[model samples]
Target chain A: MSGQLLVFVICGAFAVLGALGLLFFHKAVHAALSLALVMINLAAIYAALDAALLAMAQVIVYTGAILMLFLFVIMLVGIDRRESHRELIPGQGVVAILAGIGTLGLLVFAILGSFPAQAVGLEAANGGNVESLAALIFGSYVFAFEFISALMIIAPIGAMVLAQQARLTAKKTQRERAAARIEAYAQKGVHPGTLPNSGVTALQDSIAVPGLLPAGRISTSSVSQAMVDRDAVVNVHAVSLLTAQRFAELSGEVPPAIIKPEPVDLVDTKDERELLK
Target chain B: MNPEMVALLAAVLFVLGAVGVLIRRNALVIFMCVELMLNSANLLLVSFAYAHGSLDGQVAAFFVMVVAAAEVVVGLSIIVSVYRSRRTTSVDAPDLLKL
Candidate 1:
């Protein structure tokens, strides 16, 4: 067998195995990696066929950019969620198998019946694959080429519109969030504070035990001390409304002062209580 | 090696891809299988281009790759949007239009 045939057989085997791996892998990320392997193998096949530009494009566009996008989406959406094994449509699997067999048979019949024994080689072309492809695309298929460019421009815009959370929706969500916080505070027999200032200033006073002071007084000191006092306040009201508000805004959780009882000792506690404090 | 033999292999690869697409439940896997089918077609195109001693088939294969790239962009965006809203990427999950 010729070297070209050997390369084709090896790459073809890899491509088939990669496709099977992609189909059977349980994890989406694994399946995506498998698809990448298949894409790379297909690029090799393209190179063996002497379509060098296509091989490079296959590697760069499909393997590099497109597969990266697939992996990104898989990760962003959380990859651990395995697809349910149960078929959504009853009898779909059997139907698909039959259809696949039918399609394959038809394709084979057509290939055997109509395909010429000898394919015309690329020797007639004046230049390399890239040069000839560029000439054809720019010369004969220029309109279709320009149309593809327009389609490419529109795709990103469409994706952005589809993925974007609308401003009105976000505002409504924020309002619902504020309402939930207020309801939570009401359930705990506490009044919710107003929104806090965005900027946090350092405390000037060097109080030995900042937690001893009421939450309202702590906000005037350093931001760190305010944070400490905010954590230590027994009475939800003792915590500065601002500090509590800021914490709620940042974490979407009520400050410890709002959730827990007051600690009798401020320091030197070894229990989980110190950690909580 | 004969061009007909290479064409036969491409056909097999395409059929395998089709079967995988039919059998796999994961939307992403189905997408990849579709890509496999496209690659097989590209291989056939290039093989024909080589056998026919013409540049047209290769040019056609190049166009197919461009179209496939565009398709990936749109298809992945749709998949991501679907996953975001429903938290699942199963091709069977999104059936709002089913009667």
Candidate 2:
């Protein structure tokens, strides 16, 4: 095969793969990334096809700006969003696949029947791809170009208008929140003040490490309940081991090289246990 | 490569995009499939430009890109707004139009 045909085959294969990835990936972010791959490969094919300017624009606009926008919005909407597999209409998948294959066959046949066998390459017409494109844009399609600017202006304005959230109620002040908290504390005996800060131990200083209370008990309110529920919270024994070792070193005691955290029975206050419950 | 090969590739991508639109549930993914279809069209335009040895097809492709960019911005914003109100990106969630 010729070099141009080779380029087309490779890029076209990758583009098809990427498009398939976009369809099959469960996560929105992954699908977005796959779409980006397809775009970049398509740009490569564009360059191979002698549309150098369009190739650059494809890389810059589609892969760079548009895909990034898609990613940004994906994150905004929810990056971990898994597409629900429950089809609204029964047998939609089979129907869609059949339709797609039929369309593809029809399109392929149409192209094979009508398309020119020999490509009259853009060597003479595109003396300079940039220059010729610029002339067409500035000379003939200038009015459409000007209208596109109007479209560009209107699009952003419309986006801004759509994105702005309308407030349905008055904003609450800090005092209001505090008052509500105090009322809850008085009526239901809930904690009124801010929760304890996350742990800052000698070797482990992560939010998953619960704060050490004054009585050497782990503060129930320090770590997030979500972390606790997930069993992601750092063990109190593990965090305290380093602190104990450091204290031993400070007091001129030779600490063990590998101090395995032994199970230490923590004194759980009734109120704190109730708070946890 | 001949215009037919590029046209064939574009057709495949276009069909893939159509299937994606039909089957995918996420509104954003559907929007992306729409973009894929538009890109396929742009590729065809560029290929035809090469066949005719004229710059007009490339110019048309460039216009498609501009319109596409604009469409993405507005489409994404609409998706964002819808997500905010509905708290889900599934295309089937907003079924108020369904009879």
The best candidate by lDDT is: 2
In angstroms, what RMSD does candidate 2 have relative to the true structure? 5.5
Error of 1 at A187 (Å): 12
List, residue by residue over A77-173, the lDDT tens digit for candidate 2.
Answer: 8676667899878999999999999999999988995867777889989888999889999999999999999999999999999999796457899
Candidate 1 per-residue C-alpha lDDT over A1-277 given as tens digits, one digit per residue, 9 for 90 to 100: 8777887888888887887787678887888898888889878877877778888988998899888988888777666666788876788878987887798788888777465665555656737777888889899888888887887788777777767744333445778878888897989954467532322223222332233234223222222433443353232223334555777899998777552333333323453233234
Interface RMSD of the predictions, in order shown? 2.1, 0.9
Evaluate fnat for each of the predicted models and list the values in order: 0.64, 0.88
Docking class of 2: medium
Candidate 1 Cα errors over 4 Å, as ranges:
A165-277
- TM-score, each model? 0.69, 0.77
Q: RMSD in angstroms, all models?
A: 12.1, 5.5
lDDT of 2 by residue, B19-53 (tens): 99999999999999999999999999999998888
**lDDT values of the candidates?**
0.72, 0.88
Tell me, by DockQ, which candidate is best. 2
